[model samples]
Target: MKIDLSEVGRPQSPGARAVNAMTCDVEDYFQVSAFAPYIARDSWPTRECRVEANIERILALFARHDVKATFFTLGWIAERYPQVVRAIVAGGHELASHGYGHLRASDQDRAAFDQDIRSSKALLEDIGGVPVIGYRAPSFSIGRGNLWALEALREAGYRYSSSIYPVAHDHYGMPDAPRFPFYPNGPDGLLEVPITTVRMGGRNLPAGGGGYFRLLPYALSRWMLQRVNQQDGRSGLFYFHPWEIDPGQPRPEGLDAKSRFRHYVNIGRMERRLEQLARDFAWDRMDRVFLPQT
Candidate 1:
């Protein structure tokens, strides 16, 4: 399972373009980690479900650009909205798992973590009718504290994971982790692809999508990705949530000012920026970009 890092997503021939990984963490606004404190998990079943509509818009956006991306869908959503899972697979996109309940891997012990990954993988594969080999931890939760979770994923039959954010964030990050595709255990172990980051001023700055993609000026975000593509000459992995593009999503009250700002800032501008991003660069699914031989 040892892959030559240099050969990953490299241009096939001279003058060919490097294809970055386009990914979406499929979850609803009510399921966001920050909202977990303010909004009880039990109430999730009753909340207005907008993820189906949002995913429809996302699928349309990808279709317009001819971008075949990855959808790390939640088992909860798939169980409720099987059509969404079928739609993603029908659109020629990769169907991956984002765990069963959006539980942080770090928050779960080894047994619970194993069940989460296994159940989610089985559910997604059953619904999508595609072999699910990829899993992304909720909120990028598989860091140093729970590197064991990566092993759990591998044992659950996942071939790769994009679970570690290599940036210093208040919530979840392994700032010292590699910024590109790497095997956390060994060459034969599961491939852990960290989120894209730009090395600047002696530290890694967030280049991959999330709140940063929405909060930062679109130009600057593009520049960071361009730098990773041009300077480092490596394919970047960018991710966003469906809720990020849905500005009109139900906003829960009693959230802290910081939480509100992070979740809502510039959401209105996201769809436009994403359209421009898809046009500016070549994009593909994580499995195709990193595990091409599979």
Candidate 2:
């Protein structure tokens, strides 16, 4: 597959560089897919106590690794945990929107998704003091069913998005999409930086980041990221939740077999793997990597 940055709505930077982009979905443990049913969004305020320590651990890890990532915060989270939002900004990380209530893009039409994005962007900007330009759909939910959301994002003043996944997964994946950042021609020409992947036996397996990075062995994850940079000659995007680093979070009740596996498969290894990634690669914020080629 010939990877091009054009469809992602921006030109690639001219020079030899391995880009490592990392982000965190700032939501509490119960907001994840595994526990969404057991815990409703309206009840998120009550669970605020569960996330404070976990976020602290994440901030400390970022400090230790000397890595600066974009925190795609949920509007609900900012409304409840302004202190956490302030600390993340104070720690020198970028703040971006992850939707208002952790709602999936597929669940909403263009209008609803637009409302979510705009609302979330406003909240994050108010709390984080930066121009919110990036978005990652909740659970990578902006798939074929809602590719139209890209246009909404652009119109809402977003410069780029990391919502599409190139690999085939149960929840979200645009398998044949561009593997690198490109100028996706939408309403406002938004940059669609699909999550990183490497082709294997005719399949674009996800290796850039997420559960696969946490569940798999550190060596395989490292190899995949290095391969994305070496073979594609472009920066790779990686993402994880702040809760992923919080090994001590309470396990929600009523999780099915698969949901349990997906959320908690490699909880203990997340911190170690993150440290390894930070040390092995040349990392940069999304803003740094997404600049247009002059």
Candidate 3:
């Protein structure tokens, strides 16, 4: 999600202050299953204990800061860790879908993608005890080539999606879409809450937290959130994953040197940065913050 807290409701609301939403991308150790070729999906079930331990740390930190968040969880993880999903719900966090197995929505064709969304949503709602209204594609996988994914997301009953990143990147970013959240006309009139970025000098600055947030210094990340909300008159969506906070997660072998670096770098500082963000801003779950007027 974007983090431009200070610039939100600027010229638009004039003096209104916008609310920032915090979200977590929940996946099991094996669901990153991207490195599946190297580590095999079957082996993941055994590795989840470590993932669960890390998530507990995150939950404790959020409690300390009194931040309510949304967890877009994979159905597979929900099925495996029902207690984790229950805990998230009991803590009053919104439960949203992060697909079934962390597959890229863009990578799956229409029929498969459609099933993935339906299955994941049903699974998360059943386990988390909340009507799931939000979705975030695994790895920000929606782009021009897969614009059709929005129609499917709408058809599957999602109201808002935090999957677009309007920045140029090798894996996932839609560079020209609106920088802030807007309804991208789709079957369900999907609201695209893009990962935050600032259009500067014709280039987009990475303002959304995740790998970018951890890679950049905390001062810069926090300042960018304030700058976007204060200057742009829109709320910033800030998201990170439970795994991101776990620096000691087992590293998968066989990823290219660069892939390994991007996935694992800065895990050590992620939890601290998250705490700082919670204390600095008013963060709520997406279901609570993204309500549109009828």
Candidate 4:
């Protein structure tokens, strides 16, 4: 996504601001769906598990900044490391689902998708001791072809979602979708809070967090977020993985050039940039940022 650097000098949001959402997709690097080609799910037990240590680093960072975020956790990790899940809740962060086993909704049939959501939600709520009303599909997998996922989410008792990335991508994106939160296909009362994007040249460009944040200059990311809040009057939902903050974690072999580049290019710089992000804006949980007033 091309950012119009001209907006870098834009002013902050005017009085009465909406705090942007800060989120973490709580999955270990080995569990990344993109690496499925190189890593075997059954072998997940053999790989060195870094999610617990990485999560603690993230939790300490948030605590240092006094920021509260929503953690979209994988059911597999939560089930194996229930203490880590409990720690997230005890740290004053909202816990939500990132699906079981990181399976994409597009890759699953309706029955499988339904089972994934129900079981994941049950596990999260059971361990975290709170309702898991928010969910984000693994890798923003819900798109134009899977609007049925929205209905299923509502039926599964999910009140909101942040699963659709509005910008175009080789793997996942709904380019024509709205940049901010909206009800996809008019699914009644089911809010689909898309990842934030900036509109320019009549096309939506992804400015929200993820690999884009890692690839872009911090100044540009900051500018686009400010533009979204100050000019568009919207709350930005920024997301990243706990693995993003752990540069020293083990790197799997046999990765293609593109995969290796995308995953490892700037791993060393993420934590410091995240520290700046934590201080730059007021952050809150996803539900509080997107949910409507009574």
Best-fitting candidate, scored by lDDT: 1
Model 4 ranges with Cα > 4 A deviation = 1-14, 185-187
lDDT of 4 by residue, 1-294 (tens): 111111111223577565889999999999887799999999998888999999999999999999999999999999999999999999989999999899988999999999999999999999999999999999899887888888889999999988888888998998877676676545355788889899999888888888889999999999999888888877888999988988888989899998888887778899999999999988999887777647
Off by over 4 Å in 3: 1-17, 186-188
* Residue 176 C-alpha lDDT in model 4: 75
Q: Count of backbone clashes for each model?
A: 0, 12, 20, 0
Tell me the lDDT of model 3 at 102. 88
lDDT of 1 by residue, 17-123 (tens): 77899999999999999999999999999999999999999999999999999999999999999999999999999999999999998899999998889989999
- Displacement of residue 139 (Cα, Å) in model 1 is 0.8
Per-residue lDDT tens digits for candidate 3, residues 1-294, read 222212122233766666788888998555663465677666666664565676688788889988888988888888888889888888888889899988898779999999999999999888877899889999899888888788788888998888888898887787887776666673237777888787679988888787889898889888888887788766778888788887777776678887677778888888888888888877888867766546
lDDT of 2 by residue, 73-118 (tens): 8888889888988998899888888999888888898778888999
Clashes of 4: 0
Candidate with better lDDT, 2 vs 4: 4
TM-score of each: 0.95, 0.91, 0.90, 0.94
Query: What is model 3's C-alpha RMSD?
Result: 4.1
- The Cα local distance difference test for each model comes to 0.90, 0.80, 0.79, 0.87
TM-score of 3: 0.90
RMSD of 2: 3.2
Better structure of 3 and 4 per lDDT: 4
**In candidate 2, which residue ranges exceed 4 Å CA deviation?**
1-17, 186-188
Ordering by lDDT: 1, 4, 2, 3
Off by over 4 Å in 1: 1-15
